[model samples]
Target: MLGLLSESEAREVEQVVAAYPEIKSELNAMEDALTQYAVAKGIPMPADLPGRIIRRLETLDKDVPPGSTTPPQTDSGSGPILPILGFLLITALAGAIYFWFQTDELQENLNTTQTELQQLQVNCDQIQDSLEQIVLSLAVLRSEGNQTFIMRGLPDKNPGAVANVYYNTQAQQAFLDIRELPPPPAGQQYQLWGIGASGVPQSMDVFNIPQGDGINFIPVPYLADVSVFAVSLEPAGGSPSPTDVHMISG
Candidate 1:
């Protein structure tokens, strides 16, 4: 139909396609069908086919000889078709959908980022809890007339064991710091003793470090004028006096 028209007639045809919505819709639907068909049949469609089709249609629709529906070839196939933004849009859409399906790297990256964020949140919460515990302990360790007593392991039993006693000498209030120790059986616990200046070993408190942990904290009975601090393995309820299995003393 364009070939039957004069040069001026063809330019008029290109203008209509570039400026009209009806024409653009028709062009869009044609390519959409072609893409769907190619994918359904497991066939690869040339990436540039949509652009080429629009260019061809733009040229062929430029002019129509009254009641004539045929193309007329000229020196250049349909003299200078309009620049087709519709084809560019279709091309971009196709590329986006392809990447969304065929690329897992993007999804994997998103999942990894979420997992790391969760871990960081958990670590932050743990640090906050640890800070709260430290503040509580520091209040006692820094009280008026605070004194520290070190306990060393007994010569015959767990000589490697050690501890620190943080006590308020004035108030006789104390806390036990079991720094390094072995875990006893489920039915056995370790006991702390405060040996008075009178040389009498008084049971202070019962405690345990689960799973042979390196450290534990226990609130101890008042220890006014205590001359020694000691740790001994005792039955679950604890012994009334230092046990024969004393693990540490000072």
Candidate 2:
């Protein structure tokens, strides 16, 4: 049917088809089946294909003996089925491609949502930490055993600076509130000191001054037997003892 036979074999097959009506009808049926299969798989047929087939059939009819009848024609009812099947195949393929694109878009949206959720989680953590710090500062201020002291700036260093120190001896906790302070120079930080009766200043904590105007509450080490609290401007890492006292409270 596909002209794949050798020359002699082709001749023999043609002779057989001409001699036997049943064989001719079977070959035609097989050819039609193959054409339908190609259409169902979305292979396009040429526009002149029907005309070509009719011409070929007329040529074969001319070859038939004058007294012999033509072979029975197969039913044309199945002709519409192939085109319907081809349309369905094409529609299915289009639907599949559309779904693949939709899935890709959905995946990208999911990734973006996950990133936003992670950022929200980080914000929640920061808020929780700030709340905890406020609660601790309040506890230090309200405690009965807490000692409160007011620190004033030195006349020469920073006369405008002032702060409050809260020391809870019973709980061994200390907090400092900066009421007014200037921003430290680059590569420098503010250091807190706990001066005991021995006249020696113990290094407590070093911190950076925030940019805003609101008072900042900071936690510091609660050293034993301290009689005074002080703050100093020091290097990046604080010195062992005070280098330049900015504020003091006895």
C-alpha RMSD of each candidate structure in angstroms: 11.9, 14.8
lDDT of 2 by residue, 156-195 (tens): 9999998888888898878888888888999998999988
Using lDDT as the measure, the top candidate is 2
lDDT of the candidates, in the order given: 0.65, 0.70
Quote each prediction's TM-score: 0.48, 0.61
TM-score, predicted candidate 1 vs. hidden true structure: 0.48
Per-residue error for 215 in candidate 2, Å, reads 7.5
Q: Pick the candidate with the highest TM-score.
A: 2
Off by over 4 Å in 1: 1-108, 129-141, 185-187, 197-202, 210-217, 221-227, 236-242, 247-250
Candidate 2 wrongly placed segments (more than 4 Å): 1-81, 210-217
> Please, what are the lDDT tens digits per residue for candidate 1 over residues 24-116?
566567567757866775555566766765665755456433454233334566632433433444444456545643454566678889999
For candidate 1, what is the lDDT? 0.65
